[model samples]
Target: MFILLFSAVLAESLVEIVNSDPTSSWVAIDYPREVITLAKMRAMLGDETEVDGLETMEYVEPDGVPTSFDARQQWPGKLFAVRNQQSCGSCWAHATSEAVGDRFAIKGCSKGVLSVQDLVSCDKNDNGCNGGSGPRAMSYAQSRGITTETCLPYVSGNGRVPSCPSKCKNNSTITRYKTQNNPTFTVANVQQELMNNGPLYFRFTVYSDFMNYKSGVYQHKSGKQEGGHAVLLVGWGVENGVKYWLCQNSWGPSWGERGFFKILRGNNHCDSEKGFWAGSVKC
Candidate 1:
């Protein structure tokens, strides 16, 4: 009993065993929650970072936003509630849908939640739940258009990507949108876009240590490379002298900071200072 207890404690010190693989009996997390195994976790990252996103030359509404701001509290009624992506690597879908959904609200077009499952299942160019590209997902909305959450709710929570529905799952109203890249991807530009428009999309590198993140401004403390991930950056602020960018995760509200987390800002923290994109809801 003493030996077993010691082993358990040692394992936990390194990583949390959210779920165990039934057959392998491996201490690492299995499926449907958060993949703890390094390989599987890396596989979850589908963001194509090879493409050059480093560029800056555009307008900046300097007077539109304050130095420190949070869209959740400042804007209100323009954002959607936190959602759970389960074990599926559908972060791309969530980021794109949430950002575009916010545009709908900000534009006074619709207040309904956009269907992320629609993108996951239907966007054949990118893998369903396995992983996807944020920019591709945004362009999908632009060309093909997405539906309302009520129309085709998410059904990939079990880890496996579900088949695309022939039409809206239970409704008929399709919420379409079009996205354009933020050419001038700077901290100031990102903040101005968030305050003026809404959430924006970006692909950031995710390390294994991120799984254990509880709170505080997160930096790549310690852990092997997991892979690139996509998230909807909502706001930015300074906490206890730590400057951070606020982001809404698709890992459900039970995870980090009520489904949100603040990461280190400036100097392209987590590569968020690049590969940024945002769009509007096409009525």
Candidate 2:
């Protein structure tokens, strides 16, 4: 009990110090005070995967790439609603589903939400709620495909992944939405991928200070290493001379800027530029 209280108090003090910095590009909040232990916070973020020499999609820089771009604004209602993984380390599943769903929408396919639960329970290549890789999830989506949220639905919030179901909740036949190829995009062509495809899945190292992020361009300032997390990379922009990537997190709409946050771009802060995965949908 004493340890938990001490940790919470220490984190709160750190937030105060971060907010007090007048030159800080971001603001911190004490919203994640409920997560008393590092293990609990880590449970919300999946482990990061190594992507050295991993094959990335072939690319050529498209003309007229703008300095500022947002996938949510570019495709309006095509992006799925920001979701919450709760205490489950299923960020890999959530990010992959959002990216695939966004691509499906952009490709003039079904605009309905895809099932993260399908990936969580059925993707044998992944460990479900414990932790998974974004690239592995993408590969699973390409090979086996994923069903709609209406077919399987998500129930892993309590850190328990239910058994994979063979049929939809309503007993209707399952429709597996798939992507043509498991294409990995690099930081050099991330903007072009977003402009041509949609939101993409990427993992990053999460720090304790990042849990308190409220708004603005986030750059890790303090706190110990927590774990790795995956999020949907939506777009990019320059805020106050700092280039940042706009991302949508799965911690729900209450956290950050309506479930979206901007992080330092170009320099690969938090390893956010690594593990990029996006592909063309197969409807």
Candidate 3:
């Protein structure tokens, strides 16, 4: 019993386990920490039930979808930079906004960064900071539209989502942009959509070990289940004989690899390879 207790404690020390494990596909390092409880982690993912209704758009598989693909490489100078969601469990908002923003940029729209705060505050369908799903946020983005990040900058990192504003913070004649033609791509054709469009939005079960991800491809070597968290699916490739999905997180650039991570791919680790949603910007 004593040995089991000690082993559990050791496993909880992310830095220790990650650094010592020879077989760990990923790496970990210590950083200034936040006391993220299980409840908060659960809130990070929000309600994803709305995603069940997504209609899978048919796509004729194109010849030669690359074995490896990265949106950043494909569309240089267009994709928005990584952003921080702060203390708010607004990954849902960030992922949807960022994915839409990327589509906008890929389509040669004038703006790149969209207002995550716009969805966090104004989208009545979602639960603000407490939690929301990618599809619901996409739905909100489609119907009502969202403004640029410059117009209504994100200030809800402190966990308090401000009231929906009637006008932009900069008051520069807000031009709202909407996403059109919601398309759902399954594992069979996900890469094709990403190659044709921009980033895709999806949610996956995040484990406690995920918080300690520093670099390399991650595969849940240890730790307990945290909760579902939404993120932007950016790319995928194989590293050291292991396949991984390169995803961007909203926790900011300080976390993971410049606010991005790679998880076990193809096998649907944490359901990462499930159907994902993306759309073109109605600029």
Which prediction has the highest lDDT against the true structure? 2
Question: Residues 117-216, candidate 3, lDDT per residue (tens digit)?
Answer: 9999999988888888766788887887889888889998778988988888966677778888666678777787888888988778777777767899
Per-residue C-alpha lDDT of model 2 across residues 1-283, encoded as one tens digit per residue: 8877887886787788789988789998877554324556678888556655554433333467898999889999899988988889999999999999888888888648999899999998899988889778988988988899988889998999888887899999888977899877787777888898899987788888888888999988888888889899999898998888899999888889999999988766777765588868765
How far is 250's C-alpha from truth in model 1 (Å)? 0.8
Model 3's TM-score against the true structure: 0.87
**TM-score against truth, every candidate:** 0.79, 0.92, 0.87
lDDT of 1: 0.69
**Alpha-carbon deviation at 262 in model 1, angstroms:** 0.5
Which candidate model has the greater TM-score, 1 or 2?
A: 2
- The global Cα lDDT (0 to 1) of model 2 is 0.83
Scored against the true structure, residue 120 in model 1 reaches a CA lDDT of: 86
Query: What local lDDT score does residue 190 receive in model 2, on the 0 to 100 scale?
Result: 74
What C-alpha lDDT values do all the predictions have? 0.69, 0.83, 0.77
Worst 10 residues of 1 by lDDT: 21-30
The TM-score measured for candidate 2 stands at 0.92
Local error of candidate 3 at 230, Å?
A: 1.0
Q: Each candidate: how many clashes?
A: 0, 0, 0
Q: Who is ahead in TM-score, 2 or 3?
A: 2
Off by over 4 Å in 2: 32-40, 52-63
